[model samples]
Target: MVKIRLKKFGAAKRPCYRIVVQDSRKPRDGTTIEEIGTYQPVTQEGENQFTVNEERAKYWISVGAQPTETVKKLFSKKNLNKK
Candidate 1:
């Protein structure tokens, strides 16, 4: 099954993540089908926490991609409610 999930990256102490579409059985940072957004923790004040292409996200959902638990929570936090 195709899954929308996070791909981790960045240095040892600093972390960044790319929200991507990939097969559910693959590793978290393995081959991806598409990139949908990004997430960065606030190491400093007032940094952009996350960004997502809403239209693309909706398109992927329509095509039957399922979001991971974390991704689903992110969507809910952004009021992007999905089934």
Candidate 2:
């Protein structure tokens, strides 16, 4: 099974995340098939805080890649325009 989920990265106090597609059984921060976006919760709340390739994301989902709850919410919040 494959899933779309977050991979953590960044400094000790400043956390960032990559939205990735990977095998469901793999480790959370393990290698992924592809990276579809990024999330920076510490940054100002707006389109600049995240960058998602919505087209790629939809393609993965259609093929049965399930996204985590948090990633799902992020997708919904992002308008995917103006960038």
Best by lDDT: 1
Query: What tens digits encode model 2's per-residue C-alpha lDDT throughout 1-83?
Result: 99889999999888999999999999999889999999888876554778889899888887888888888788778642222
lDDT of 1 by residue, 1-83 (tens): 99889999999889999999899999988899999899887467877889999988888888899998899988887776563
Residue 41's lDDT within candidate 1 is: 76
For each candidate in turn, give its C-alpha RMSD to the true structure in angstroms.
1.3, 4.2
C-alpha lDDT values of all predictions? 0.88, 0.85
Against the hidden true structure, what lDDT does model 1 obtain?
0.88
Q: Clashing residue pairs in candidate 1, if any? A: none
Which residue ranges in model 1 land beyond 4 Å of their true spot? none
Give the Cα-based TM-score of candidate 1 against the true structure: 0.90
